[model samples]
Target: MGFPDDTPPGLAGVLATLRGDVEPSSLWATLVDLAIRGVASVHCCKGALLSGGKEYLLRWNESSSLAPWEQEAIALLEGKRKGTEREVSLLSLFQTLAFGSKGYRKALEGSLEGAGLWSRERESQRKRVLLISLLLLFLGLAAFVVGLIGADAWLGLPGARAAVAALLAGAGVGAMVLFLPYLLVGALSSSLTDQGYRRGLQWRAAAKALKEELKGEGFNVERWGGDRFPAYSIALNLTDAFQEAVKKGKITAAPPWFSTALADKAEVVQFGALIALMTASSTGSAAGVGGGGCSAAGGGSGGAG
Candidate 1:
């Protein structure tokens, strides 16, 4: 089958290649390969497979070096299998591959917003501490000056010089004691602000990398309200020209069993999901083959606040 007349060249081209004269077994193998490549591209997990008829298992590649927060975010995703090394649900894995870095992007966005807020707050606190410290020092110096002048005028003797010196020393010592705590607090707050700023920058850099990766894959990528808002938002519009081709009967739908078998045997369930997607695309049916349609491939946000 051929793509619809209006299909975009990028997507149409990919579908045309996939739908070329090939055996069902060969098609399945191709899908499996694509699925593995897709997962590896994001460096999230190795692959996924159906397990026990009702569940899907996603395996994490131990070789992949993930950030601590990334690991935590994956753990929080639904269908996580405890005690298993980096295994998640087939559905979750499928969503991740189909969408490409949405989960990580979302997590990074939230972290960036939080860190920014903390940095701002800490900066304000440090300023306040410095102001208070300066005020105390100034008041102490002013009082010492007054005491020196009063001693000279009232005592009118050499002994008054000693008294004035003692007074000055005591005032200096008191000022130092009062300033120390505030100075320490100011330093602490400044350090905290720097740390928060660094964290925010890290998150932004990670999100930017993910966005660039998706763009490299030919997805239409857009960033919205980042400059105006703390939580930077991203939107991905997948080239659905392939879906349009399927809907127009320009491509042949994969066999239902093909989707099922692919889902069951592939290391990553995304391959099976893509196969199922093909069935839905070709038939122009919202109904999925073995399970649901791969319509989730459409662009969407991980969310921002």
Candidate 2:
């Protein structure tokens, strides 16, 4: 409920993605948050989706443990309706999980709006941009046409036609400037409301704190809520923090929720590397699902893009 506590960072990634400034990695973050809440589990397994390397086993703690958008993501998983406990694979995630499920994005955005983080009338911005561009184009063309028809026909000056040509050219250039760039793209779209803007300033400071707390020197993983950090770190685009912590011996063991098949068990970094690999490899896929980029809210309070 507060900024960057332990719950997958409050869907911060979703906010920035909808703002169109970044892609999202909220799916992974959300899963980790769910796991923290004792709703899911993920561990390295022995098979691959298409390649011949390792994959992960994802288990649902309960049949109805997911959020509505989360539900939409794995809605069609092979065994969702079988029983209280269910299992799926990371390989299957490629086929499942729409990073940008419109429903999911909309729902979170709506919640943020309700919480006064941003505005909800975003569709209107797109419409307004398109309408204004079209209007400007029509007006410019109409003026150019009328001007040409009503102009003095070089009766006294041979240069009159040339002058008219220059006017038409100028009008064309003006129209193109107004209609060809960002206006036609995502014109008038705004992600921050006044309250959101105030909150944004706080989020920046929070992000800096994240770097220090998670990756800074001599940081103790156990004292830092290690279990939540590994996954949430990735969601927040601080995979380095997780990796660095492991490399420097700050993290020697993984939290219980993250495990491997080997009896001796993989090193923390190995498991982390696999997590990073799977997430990066699936970046393209997350974008297809509607995730904008690597981002997440703080442990609870703020967001990062």
The candidate that wins on TM-score is: 2
lDDT by residue (1-305, candidate 2, tens digit) is 11443333435654434352223456666666666656665655444323434445566544465656466444544443333435555554654443444555565566666677767565567667778877777777776665565454443456567577557757866776767674547653556576665555554555556567654465755544556665556555666666777777777876556665534445475567755754564365321111111111111111100
Per candidate, the number of residue pairs that clash is 5, 22
RMSD list, candidates in order: 20.3, 9.0
lDDT of 1 by residue, 136-235 (tens): 8787777677766666565746655768756875786689778978877665443233444443344435434434544344332123111111111111
What C-alpha root-mean-square deviation, in Å, does candidate 2 show against the real structure? 9.0
| Lowest lDDT block of 10, candidate 1 | 228-237
Mark the regions of model 1 whose C-alpha exceeds 4 Å error after superposition.
1-56, 67-69, 77-79, 82-86, 91-106, 110-239, 242-260, 263-305
